[model samples]
Target: MKGAPRMPQDDADAPRFARRVGILVTGIVAVSFWIVTLLGALAVVTRFVRTIVVPRAKRTEPVRVRDVDLARGEIEFDADGDSRTPGRYSFWFDDDEGHARVGDITGGGAVTVTRRIIGVDFGDLRGVSRGRLGSWFHLAPGEFGHPYSDVTIETERGPAPAWLIPAAEPTDRWVVMVHGWGGRRPECLRAVETFHRAGYTCLIVSYRNDGEAPDSADGRYGLGDTEWRDVESALLFAGEHGAGGVVLAGWSMGGAISLQTVLRSGHAASVTGIVLDSPAVDWHDILAFQGTLNRLPEPITRTVVRTLGNGWGRTISGLATPIDFARLDVLGQADRLRVPIHILHSRDDGFVPHNGSARLAALRPDIVSYDEWGVARHARLWNYDSDRWDRSVSGWLTGLEG
Candidate 1:
């Protein structure tokens, strides 16, 4: 029978075919798993660079100025959305001497007007150029003519530049100010006025990888992991100067750095108080919120955190060794804060979550004073309502005095 027709043996053929099918399925699954793992690793690397790298300046928006009606004291320009977008904006441009001139925004539409142009010093705006006016909402200290000295503080890396503005009423208490991620020293100008008025010298600081400051070996941010040391150097500088004690004030990521400096730096005894504006109290929460905003699922955030926190995982994610994301959890260690802390956070903050701030305040009610605002996003508490911000900080200072 075998030689003549090879009569089908169903039992023998079926097992071999089934074994082949099983092998195919197993190979498919193994390939799929590797592909997914590679993709996840790539995603982690991309997020690492974007989150920690200091972004370069983009070329200025192609002169959006359409027209300038000198007679009516108005200018026409394009905005991100409707020019009528409700918020404060300032008209800015370089004058003949290349000094920045800014004027208050009177109204916004297709056409907008500016008032009290700086440098020109003309009411209703005069000596204004028909060229592009780089409008900004955040005001810099240069516009106010507040005298400040450019000083450098020595850090482990190198010298980092800072702006030292002495208070008119001059007290021994120094206020060291740190700006947020991608923010410059000018961002502290709003808080500077309040601190100066309270008789505190203000030191607007620049840390590693901040362009003006010396670049880190990796040229990537530690998210307050290593930047805290630069802040410690600034604190030492203040102590060497006329500062009897210091009040550390920070905005956004700056707040994270400030918190780390307080907790880790040996200079904790010198820092009497801390003021955080929309701070990233817990990096874990912030990353999770960011994942939500960017439409990434919880698993991706968890993977990212794990990748950033460990050595081998960081290598896969294209990060240098030693990130220390665990230490960025300031809220987790709220009880460790010995000095009084004042936190100003916005419920509408699009970046860092307010829950961490609230939790920290609740956990250490005896040492932490929480002030909530809903007017603006991220580190824009002052821009939304400067009067209220000033009053709050001033009140805290008064409380410290008492």
Candidate 2:
């Protein structure tokens, strides 16, 4: 009876039972691990969605600083009169003043504020830490709208413009040259000499910060803000000095401003042609380049730019001359151009890409003629191959005249 009761199933059965227990334990451990990992992932995603993604979108807004067009000093009316202080633009007002064509004030800063005025600023404006205090724009000497230009224009604060007319019979055809940041009229001398010999009268202009001109506001450089107006004034001077038609030629940032002056939509009837060398199309894009060159990306670039760049116009140039990247800006309108344009750039330009000129030609085949050479960085193509440069530009202009 004892022997019958004690019958073990088998050694094989014992081993099989152990194997089943091991499989169950392994399955449980795997399931537990996966569940823990899923919870961790959800936590990370929630933080990302809430902290980084949601706040940026929610806080973003389009800037809207109202422009209050004041009457010219001769007028005594309240139509656009502002008495914030003497000449400085006021930034205290918050409401959008409908469409009153007021003096332009661009705004932005590191702190939270409803409005900010950039180009020119008075201490009266609220929500602004500081604003630029200087001339809004510069005026050049030239006669505009006249059959020819042969006069001098005195800037608002400066002496009469110096016109270094070539020592020859005054020529009706003109090439008005504008230079870039830290550059003076002398910077365009190389190109000017060729044009001078080609029988084209050349006039080099001085902007707010060039050739004895006063310092810019905020002590910083604007790629093109107030400088564009200087070019406009210069164009008018050219017309007065007996220039039958105007040829605007600029280098680097000056090139960009020259284009803006000519392409100023509602008024481009006077300009005969345009020449830009290594011009930047979008300033914001340039800043992006600055970031990349420094190896900063995404949120860091966005943050630093948002923080320091907000006050850039106000602090850096010592002139709060805010440059609106919008505003019928020339770079935006490669098409819709009815006039002739010749762009010169280099493949090795360090500051601006040759592709900008290329893009312009691609956009407006009829108006734009692009030249991206292989040597001489930035606007120095002429120095690299002076003969070629002179021939290309001088020939193009002569052909146009004929």
What's the TM-score of each model vs. the native?
A: 0.79, 0.57
How much is the lDDT of residue 60 in candidate 1? 34
lDDT of each: 0.74, 0.55
Query: Whole-model lDDT for model 2 versus the true structure?
Result: 0.55
Q: What is the lDDT of residue 347 in candidate 2?
A: 76
Residues 1-402, candidate 2, lDDT per residue (tens digit)?
A: 531223338985777666666787888899999999767654433332223111122222123323322322111111211211122222222231111111322332332222222333222232322222211112222222212233355554344354545525666787778777555554565665566666777777767656445444443344565556667777677677687777778887787777777666233566788877777765556556655765655554444334333455233223354445564245576655677888888776766767667777888878788877875566666645667888888788776787
lDDT (tens digit, per residue) of candidate 1 on 1-402:
332323337877777667766787898899999999888767665664456544445423333454555655555555433233333434434331232333445555544533323343323333433333322343456655778888999999899989888888767899999887776776777787788878898998999877778988777777898889999999999999989999999988899999999999998789999999999788888888888888876777777777677776655544565578767777667778899999999887877889889999999999999999875667767755778889999999989867
On a 0 to 100 scale, what is the lDDT of residue 210 in model 1? Answer: 77
Off by over 4 Å in 1: 1-37, 53-140, 316-318
Model 2 segments more than 4 A misplaced: 1-152, 216-219, 265-267, 300-321
